[model samples]
Target chain A: MVSITEGKPLEHTLEQLSTTREVTILSCNTCAHYCGTGGRLAMDHLAFHLNNNGVTVVGKELVTKVCIQEQLRGCNHTKTIVLMACSSGLISAKEAWPDAVIVPTNSTLGIGSYDPDTGSATLLFPFPGHETSRGARFPSLNTEAIR
Target chain B: MIMTLRRLDYHALIAFLPRDARVLVWSCNTCARLCNGFGGKEATKALCSMLAEDGLEIVGGEVLSVSCFKSVIRKRLDRADLRMMAEKATHLIPLTCRTGVEMMRNELPWLEIVEVGETVGLGYLSESRGAVLTNSIVEMLDLPDEGIPLSEVAEDLGLFLGPFER
Candidate 1:
């Protein structure tokens, strides 16, 4: 099963990072990657956009699985972190770095099953309160994504 | 890891299938496996053996890396040997989480799918305490600060700890 999430609006993410001096972008390359929210490509794109918009992206860490608390411990020691993983990953980061300012860029929809042939994931079994999203297809973050 | 519990006992499971049922045992090797050996290669083998002893026609036993991926399940089902095995089967017994069982249903609509696992919530593997439930979609919302152990959660829910037993 895959943990599914949708990227927050670009404007909202930028606003959250507006006051930060230097921020680290932490992305998970597994389920989030499959969901097109948190991955190497997404991280790099976000970093580039942030840099172009006068924001200093100090670091970009692409963890294989950020939900694992141990794996999340290696994130850059920045004051602000723009986390691009699911809520579970965000919780792990919070537990790992209690003092750091963690900003989430994705909304956890729930768990899903991926279809490699279609390169898409369906929200088969949603988390609590996300029952309406069950059977919903993967979100298109392409609009919010910076080219 | 995704936490799951045995949804049916062996007796209940056997009685649910048709009299002339040809069974194909399917299992997931990831989260379900971590759930106290709930679903995995070994679990599949054990269930298959038990069914055979009960005089059921066991078509075959298959193990998936992650049954939650429809593509993975579909790819495996498309294989010539697997397709033949599936063709010979009337009912699919899945030793996987509910999501995995649902994917099997979507891919193989022709066969009657038998779900034996009930997915509870998501959890992480703990070095000292085993699998711990962190996010639950079910009733167990007030988990401990460090999260509740999957075994404890299963026990509290009146569910089986592992694979079906004969």
Candidate 2:
């Protein structure tokens, strides 16, 4: 998975969303923080980027999780709602505000592992066809196999 | 300082070490913590333990806010303390980002420095209700793939610790 900065993709996503006047950037602190990505930092950086682009970012919120029902209430706005979390977050945000344009800032990558030596999360690329061998190999596998 | 977003080069830094030498573990608490690197207090302790197990003598370990930000203070107030610590160590293993490493290099021209983490600004990937799913794209979309190797993590830790020193 390509790990590009939100700043690199901000202009493109904004253009695609066709955000003219005001925009609302919403970030989920829970997921992004755990992932080693910018949960709060992304919101601040994006706000700065939008303001510099001559677009007025009306609202910015960094909730525990944007997918949750409680935080979905105040997210509804007439302007485009940009989600700085993952693709799943974008889907949930879109579900809440059907009318508002939901744009995703993060490219969905597979499960990643934190590298202790480098102090960065390394994307754990799933090996294709490894799942098929598991079911076919053993007759009666353990509960772990099913999961 | 040049602000370039790149992962830490642990291998390169390790290669610079001479066989098995005494080293001091230094961590940055601010930027490194923000980047999810080895600048945090917990990470500094872990690094010291890991290094000690690897047959390297750890003289001491310290967690500074920003070595560069306090370069003047580090040079003046902390100079005697640093000099005393430097005398006991063979090298300064900076468990900080590249910027911190660079700052230390410039400030202490005679001191040997090594960096342990990347300088990239951690970016957001995903979110889940109970679990904070940062980088799980496949499971998030429910696509079938060999999921995360939860079983291997224990084995990896065992390997990291080395054969039980009996």
Instruction: Please report the candidate that would top DockQ against the real structure.
Output: 1
Residue clash pairs of candidate 1: none
iRMS of candidate 1, Å: 2.4
Candidate No. with top TM-score: 1
The local lDDT score (0 to 100) that residue B11 gets in candidate 1 is 93
Model 2 regions lying over 4 Å from their true place = A1-22, A25-79, A82-147, B1-20, B30-39, B50-56, B65-83, B115-122, B125-166
Residue-level lDDT tens digits of model 2 in A58-122: 88877765534346665545457767664445555655566777666664443233322343433
Per-residue lDDT of B65-164 in model 2, one digit per residue for the tens?
A: 5543433326443667766776777788765545457656765566677644433212222123221223222322222122222112213223111111
A49-75 per-residue lDDT for model 1 (tens digits): 888887799899999877666676546
DockQ value for model 1: 0.36
Chain B TM-scores across candidates:
0.94, 0.58
lDDT of 2: 0.48
Q: What is the C-alpha local distance difference test score of each model?
A: 0.81, 0.48
